[model samples]
Target: MEKHIHNTSLFSKSAALTLTAVNVILFFITEAFPSVRAYLSLNSVLIIHGRMYWQFISYMFVHGSLMHLLGNMLGLVFFGTAVERKLGTKQFLILYFSSGLASGALSFAVYAAAGMNHVFLLGASGAVYAVLLVFSVLFPRTLIYLWGLLPVPAPILVAVFALIEIFSQLFSVNSGIAHTTHLSGFAAAWLYVKIRMKKSPLALWKEAYRK
Candidate 1:
């Protein structure tokens, strides 16, 4: 029960729901609510005053379309639940947010370095990718149905995705997806989990009691 409580709080259903709701709202903002869109975007060099740093966090909840949100959230639903079950909700939330931050930072830096100022990177793919990567780490042997068609081993499939993202970035993609950000988030999440697992609670407790 304690474990379950921890998971619930950390992987709060409300958090996911709120995130999805906002993405839905983002669609409207981008379509109907121009004024709202201005406030919600990652406007680093704002012409007028608004939430400047909101982009870092806000991008996680604002996806481009229903199809986009579905793809990301689908990954979250499958892999995220497993990770949340293993790490509990609180730890999962921390990983999710941290990956999102890293993903956004990398995207922004890359864009700026390339002099792509007007473009703003947005989406929860960064965080979702983080969850999926962790899931791959903890359960590398897990099998995933590729688009519910062919069954492929999780680790191999994930590797393929990573490779594709890296290669596709070289040749301009017509798909208009932020595959780079997804990979960046995955890498960050992988590092975070590695650091986190180093000091398990049992190890910490033993160390504390030893001293």
Candidate 2:
């Protein structure tokens, strides 16, 4: 079992930073060569008809815009570093890639079922959401600022995001946001914590608050 407590520097060399750098570099590469985006982005049609299964993993490294890349990388750098320190590099990568792949698989199933093969899903929002969820579970009491103001507990922030995603998915299906993928991230992370970590996220949050 991994210990709940860990000490590590945030800026130290880690998998999280490596991922951030890769995402940034790929963003620039894809920007210079737009055709690369089509190959990297997840599309149900491409995977089923063209046998481009690599998109499931590559989609996480490609972003639609600068803001998209910045948002995901910031979340990764912030929450991922802490999670990696607690879980160690190998376990952290497992959690990250597994959550991302699960999200992509679930999304592919949904898209194929609905016959929305033309939709292209890109970005690391899914994996980043999973990292954020793991971070909250590991540090429930940590304060996260909302828009540079209003300190909120990490768990509360995650709960709020979950609710927003559910609402958006149901009422705003055309919002151009992959709400399903984001929620899948949370679901995948929760299962990873329960089965691999042998812990309940809710129980950990409650325990932290009670202390």
Candidate 3:
């Protein structure tokens, strides 16, 4: 039997359509209700981090800033819909929610282990990163336009972002990027693909060695 190969064009009708609808829903929902969603925001407790209980799931659909929601929603529409189509919507949603929750759980674990109180985390970046991971894995040659002027390959972008994030975590003074959460998103995505594909994520590491 031949392995089924599929194209990964993110610029498709279905992906575009799904992306638009979700964005509208997210914006309206978050803006419409603020009081009830306070606890859902990402914050660091005295010693804990990423107040992740059941809200981990809801937090994925919430964004703290307009730029955040816009950027993440854009990434989701572009990177996610295509993969979701290939993986099937049901599986895609599972991967998305699981990845988000995993990110929250990991962040909370790190903070708790450090004797921190509770942390609050929000946004769909976890899902967005998972989408980025999938694209990087399946279509390594895809090109991504950054900041409207520079163009770069997908893998390079992923590597550069990961490195920059790590470096910032180690040395940067006032970086607001959630490097840890991004890393967790990648890890969660990798786990999802591993379980669904029935291949050891570590073993697959030799092939792409990426999240």
Candidate 4:
């Protein structure tokens, strides 16, 4: 016998689509205005001294470059749809925004503590990474293509990224990428899956390994 899962989404629209649209619109907005990126991007100094709290949410919408925007949006669209469908709109929003906000907070703290108050971190990579982590955990056996070529299991792919981020954070590597935010997103996603789905990532990994 097979079990059929019925969706109980309050909204008919996809959360993934809404997120991608907002990000694309904001990217163009920053490009046209230019100055808006300063206001939208996460700046540790403004957040701490100037008290620009809203940047926490806005930073996720702005990307540094066209490639950066495309990469994050691609991840969101590919991984987010499945996660949103399983969690529904409300829960999906919770997971997405919460992870993004938490990543911003982590970035702010790390930069401020390091005396790098002028540092700015932008893009939806953190939130997208969180969504990817959750999707991989839930669909461990799902095949994911690396660089549109070699096939790798979703869980293993996500695990590789997680390990890379952990190493980068530990070594204080300056790769112009916010590795701490990536780790924070992974942490937030792990907690959400554990609490909401009552499934530990360890167990999920073991199950995947057995296969």
Candidate 5:
């Protein structure tokens, strides 16, 4: 498993670039044809009733707005590239898709239970959040600039984002931001790193901090 995670030669394609291009292209196409968004966005009603099951994977490639697309792509370019280089394209792809699919499934269950059938969940934020967490774990001491200003350590940044998501999910449920999905992404990523990589993110962060 360790060898598989670190073997860059396993795949020659750049998953991050491919995903970014697909997202950009899809954004323009979906913007031009508003009807297309319905098929790509994850709606509980559409999934459960209409059987539009593809939305589980499709939603990750679609975004609600230009800012949403840009924000997600930027994170993919920054942390994703580093992670891919470190963990190899195969592992990075596993982390990305697993986090996304898992979050979608979890969100679907929550939305169904809460009777939010009309709510449409779209965007790569969930997968991006997972990538961000993995980056922090793999490179805990690395510094990330918030808004190109305040330099913060990677693990600390993930912790702050986790707190923000938890607060938003609890107090600002109607924020239309899918705070629960984001938190789910973090959870999914934590599990991937733990079960697949056999490394504890907390332990890694503590070891890095001690240095």
Candidate 6:
């Protein structure tokens, strides 16, 4: 049983590490070959008119800056490994990619609705947000440090982040962050988690009301 558990644990961590490496390697490749960004990065108008649907997945691996890459990889390594361990490699991969694709779809719809269909999005923040959220759900009482100091419970932290993103999205803030996609990821992941747990999405709220 111990060996079985050990083997189960190994795959998830390795998969998380591989994902982080791929993101970093792709970032460097795009840096050295700038033209490659056109093919891999998300271009909203091109996707709608030109049918560059592959951008939905490809854009998740590309980053807009070193800081962006660093921040995402840090989250991927920290929260991703834990979530992967909980879900196993196959489910983890499904969650990661599906949340990313969902975010892309929602972003496209929002851009089209806002008459800003030409605005492009690029980054793995959406997928990372999903992983972070899953971590929060699975380990709600875990204390997460803010700036290496102020400890906050995981659920509260996730809620705070979601609220911030919603606020940013509603106000059309010039923060350059993809708040819509971030919120979409959180929604997608929340639904996915509910399905996986064989519970209705509102069950948690119902339980809280009963309590």
Best by lDDT: 2
Query: Which stretches of model 5 miss by more than 4 angstroms?
Result: 1-12
lDDT of 2 by residue, 1-211 (tens): 8768564854355999989999999999999999999999999999999999999999999999999999999999999989999999999999999999999999999999999978999999999999999999988989999899999999999999999999999998557999999999999999998997588899888888898
- What are the per-residue Cα lDDT tens digits for candidate 5 across 1-211? 4554454542246789888989999999999998999999999999999999999999999998999999999999899999999999899999999999999999999999999978999999999999999999988889999989999999999999999999988898558899988998999999998997687789878878888
| Reference-based TM-score, model 3 | 0.74
Q: Candidate 4, residues 54-119: lDDT per residue as tens digits?
A: 999999999989999999989998899898888888888999999999999988888888888768
The all-Cα superposition gives candidate 5 an RMSD in Å to the true structure of: 4.6
The whole-model lDDT of each prediction reads 0.71, 0.93, 0.69, 0.88, 0.92, 0.85
Tens-digit lDDT string for candidate 6 (1-211): 4555455554345788889988999999999998787778777787878898899899999998999999999999999988888888899899999999999888877777778865778899999999988887776667899999999977778889988998887897856899988998999889898889776434543453455
Error of 5 at 73 (Å): 0.5
Question: Which parts of model 6 have CA positions greater than 4 angstroms off?
Answer: 1-13, 200-211
For all predictions, the C-alpha RMSD in Å is: 7.1, 4.7, 6.6, 4.5, 4.6, 3.4
Ranking of predictions according to TM-score: 2, 5, 4, 6, 1, 3
Model 1, 11-97: lDDT tens digits are: 245445445555667776676755655555554454223437777787777666678778887777778777877887788888889
TM per prediction: 0.78, 0.93, 0.74, 0.90, 0.92, 0.87
Give Cα distance to truth, residue 168, candidate 1, Å. Answer: 1.1
- Clashing pairs for model 5 are none
Which has the higher TM-score value, candidate number 3 or candidate number 5?
5
Model 4 Cα displacement at 42 (Å)?
1.0
CA deviation > 4 Å runs, candidate 1: 1-18, 21-34, 47-51, 199-211
Off by more than 4 A, model 2: 1-12
Which candidate model has the greater lDDT, 3 or 6? 6
Which has the higher TM-score value, candidate number 3 or candidate number 6?
6
